[model samples]
Target: MELKKLLEQQSAEAWEKYIPSLSIDCVIFSFYENALHVLTVNMKDQNLWGLPGGYVQKDENVDDAAMRILKDRTGTENIYLQQFYTFGNLKRSESAFEAYDDSIWNKQRFVSIGYYALAEHSQVKLRIDQYSNAVEWKLIETLPEFMMDHRAIFDKALLTLREQLNNHPIGYNLLPEKFTMPELQKLYEAILGKKLNRGNFYRKILRYDILIKLDESRKGGAHKAPDLYSFDLTKYNEALKEGLKGNW
Candidate 1:
């Protein structure tokens, strides 16, 4: 009973001194027309684009706060969100807070954690808040002048996604449930920002043995329709554990 009382006392003490300053930033990524896209919110007063982020509430977990921020900013939920890294550099810029008339930056130092979500472009319905002038999708290659160190944060998230693609099934997050072989190949080319030999790419993907060939093919008139395929998550998980090589 004495040990239980001590445990209760420590828990109470810990709660009393906790100051909630943790924030979460979501780097919502999507693919469209052979290009990677990132969601950006335009600040009305600063005329700068920034990632959708929010402070974690005292009652909510870090992952919960990230999902809330993504839903509130992009009207997206039930999407795949992965915690990539945390940015706690003391010298990180808080210039965006200075842009406001209120002394928002004078509060306690904030240590923001970054999370990324991948979803189809057609699934997101962006809703800009009062403080934000607009919310729109910006091509990864052509990001606007942003505020704070958001550009660096975004770059790190993209790098993590690329690294994950080598060993994990990242293509499912970027493409539709049923996609053509050429479409799948192009998606990788876009993410890697390079051209891949069509024949070799096909061979490599086939060797993985994680794709389910569907009977349907792309309906077109110009040329032969490419066969449709879908990822087998069951097989993918097993193969992913073995680590995939992207030599092709």
Candidate 2:
């Protein structure tokens, strides 16, 4: 069946199968080349950009709904998700959904649950969802004007990411399996939106004892190679459970 027909049929009966006033928005943060980027879509409105989002099914768990929407929109699954915040302000959904029927939407105020995720930038395969085009990552600092409260959502996500990096070992998911100390430090700096003294950062991270240094180094660079490190996944997993912060 054509996607348009399917959408119309679903909209006709959406109230029966989906929650009318609740939706989900995802802040997919991608870190690469020592910078933080966010996944934004044109949403058929070339002038306005927003986070990838969708309505929730009536029978769906919010977490499951987030995973479904992420996979459907990005063609990737099993990415880790963290529920960040819920935006319930009356004006949150003021922007118009031009492609959607007014009768199906605009019937009620919407409350959006925001989720943040971290995954290697290369693993993401962008796919066109129902209303997005030219989907791509935009630097967090240089994002275009957001359509709704998406900029607010991204800000909350970034703050959560910084907290998680400090309290959990989740940041490894955003880095290569084996990485140089500089690369790891840069990732944290990018997410934190600040620079740290190289020596202080290195010393602080090393005390965590969560990295397994390897003799191998980053190759093919003109500069002297820095020692490579692989995450001690065993310790990292334990840290995720017990927490790792302020021990330095």
Candidate 3:
């Protein structure tokens, strides 16, 4: 059967199972190769890509639904997720369903709850659902055409992350358990879209007191081995609750 026909058949069932006119979209970010990337899926029969998303079930809490969706795509539940914004612009997602009848659940004007997530790149196991042809991480700087208003959604999520850097500690989820000071700084630089003074960055991060220097140093790099550090969960959690004191 054709994809649209298949969707039309499922439309009725979707309306019965989910809340009307509501959906969730996630911006899943990860750091790798000294760059930032976002998880995207290329929907079947469409040239454009979109953020990983799904409808909200009638009986499920919004936060739980978000967690469920993230877990379905990434194969992990240890991600750091935050609801950043809600997108309800007129005709935002309607054009994509233009071929379907008005009765089709997907044709409705959806009010999407936007969430931004951080996960370790190596830890994520990307999965593709029935509607998608490909599920992969795309570099933020070179994103392809995005479906509907997903580009706007992504831009807002990135801005929120950059703003949060001013007050909160980040990278516990994006980085490995043990990482070098330079790696940590590179992650920050990737998100902030700028370079930082190595000396100043080292001093400020140390002052934050969120990391513990491990005895071991990274091995086999061209340059001298740098010390490894891990987050002190207790202090990190404390900093998360009571906002950190300075800017980058």
Candidate 4:
């Protein structure tokens, strides 16, 4: 069967298995090549890209549904996920399915639960489900045209992430187990979308007391290898509870 036809058929089945007028959209983030990237999908027959998303099953809790959706796309259950916001602006997603019958589930007015997830870039195995032709990471700075109000959804997710930086442990899920101070700084800069003074960044991050300096340095560059460090998960979790003071 054709992809559109398959989607049309699923639209009928969706009403029976999933809650109507409710959906989940995930903004999965990763830090790679000194930039922040987001996972996106290209629909099979459309010239549009969108966040990886899915419907909420009638019997599942909303947070569980979001986790299931994230695992489906990223192939991991260990991602750091947060429920950031809800998007329900009028007609937010209805027009994307105008070519289909009004009864189509895709055409319904859905208020999406927004989630922001952080996964290590190397750990994620991007998967394309039945509805998408391509599932790939796009740099947050240079995203393709998005369908419906997905761009708005992405914008809001990014904003929420930035706001959380002051109080949250961000790089635990986004960075590798052992990373250089410069590398960690770059991740913070990527998320904050600004350049930070090296001295200030080092002092502030060290003061947080969430990282442990390893007895090693990164090897490869002609210049002196940078010192390596890893998060003290115990301290990190403690900081998460108490929240680090001050802002970027």
Candidate 5:
């Protein structure tokens, strides 16, 4: 009873008594129209664009902060958010403060933890904050002038995603519920930034046996109809644990 009474009494003043200097930045990536897309927001007083990011609240966990940031900026939740890295170089602090206004500088110094997330583009409804002028999707190849080291952070996230593509079945996140093999192949090519052998790539993915063919095809009439396939999450999870280790 004493501990509970103390906890109730101290809860209101806990934040004012102690504050941690930590922040979360999310590199939200999606695949659209055969290209990779990244979510960016422009600050109200600055001309630069940057990834959706925010400082962690006093009572929030790091992972919860990341999810809250995503929801605040893009109206997205419950997506795959993974911590890719922690950028703690001394220079990073200077750059981040420089990107902001004098009012923000009044706060204590902070080091940011970076997280990258993958979600379907259609699932998000962006909500611009008071400090942000607008939020929009930009092609990964043609990014605008970003604040601080966000560009570097984005590059690292993409590199991490590409490295794990072969071992994991994340490429499915880039596709619709039912998609053609060519569309799936194009997503891999976009991320890998290389042209893959068509026949060889198809055979390699088929060997996983994680895709189920559906009785559907393209609605147009210009070219041959390709078979549609949906990812089998159960088998894909099993294959991910086994790792993709066949001849390519």
Candidate 6:
């Protein structure tokens, strides 16, 4: 009853229970230290990598199936997940995942729905499934060769994420419960893909009036400690409803 065998049997069963055309792909983004990264996995003997994804089951809701896949891959649940785009181009899966030994996978074409979520990097412990030989976070800007149209999917997901930041505070998922102002600004700079003026960024963010500055100071090294703060979720939600403008 090895996981590999179980997964192989499940792959056979997938032909019967899973949709022939529809699938789900997750772009889990995490802000680690000062850089942004995406979760990627490579199958056995395959040099290419792609996002965490799976097929939709016949009786299951697509959203539920997506959540299950995310939990199985990242060991994290309850994080907010948003469905962003559906990739329906013909031959989207052509020649993808070809290194796998499973014959069933080669028998069909798949159109995948792309979903995305952000999580605190420190909170996640990756769980590789039977199909993947290894898993790691890769820099979005310098990703390796991807299978099929996953490169296009990643690009769309990044664009969608940047758009979400402009209208929502969902980016908070990428940080710890308490953070310094510089930490928050660093996140914006990473997502917006540009540096911002320190004075301007601080003033714009402070105008939201949703952060609770704590008396504690950020400590790790000998650098001068900065005051720590946490966002008031109630006020944050209200501000999100009003939609945050890109002043930075």
The model with the greatest TM-score is 4
Q: Which of 3 and 6 is the better model by lDDT?
A: 3
Q: Predict model 6's lDDT versus the native.
A: 0.81
lDDT string for model 6 (1-248, tens) is 44345556677677788888788999999887777899998865555688889888889999999999999988989777889999998777856544346465443578899998887788788987667778999887789888878889988988888888856666568878898888888888878789999999899888888789998998888888899999898888777776776233
Spell out the clash pairs found in candidate 4: none
Instruction: Tell me the spans in candidate 4 whose CA falls farther than 4 Å from its real position.
Output: 246-248
Query: Which candidate, 1 or 5, has the higher TM-score?
Result: 5
Ranking by lDDT: 3, 4, 6, 2, 1, 5
For every candidate, C-alpha RMSD to the true structure in Å: 9.1, 2.9, 1.9, 1.8, 7.4, 3.0
User: lDDT of model 6 at residue 82?
Assistant: 89
Candidate No. with top lDDT: 3
Clashes by residue pair, model 5: none
lDDT of 1 by residue, 4-94 (tens): 2333444444344333556677889898876788999886656778888876767777788788888898787878899999999874655
Candidate 2: segments with Cα more than 4 A from true spot:
1-10, 97-102, 240-242
Clashing residue pairs in candidate 3 (N, C-alpha, C atoms within 3 angstroms): none
**Alpha carbon lDDT at 189, candidate 6:** 84
Candidate 6: RMSD to truth:
3.0
| Global lDDT of model 2 | 0.80
* Model 1 CA deviation exceeding 4 Å by range: 1-19, 99-108, 246-248
The residue pairs in collision within model 6 are: none
lDDT of 2 by residue, 18-127 (tens): 78899899999877877778898886534468899888887788899999989987788978788989999986774554455667553357899999888678888988
Q: Relative to the true structure, how large is the alpha-carbon lDDT of every model?
A: 0.78, 0.80, 0.90, 0.88, 0.77, 0.81
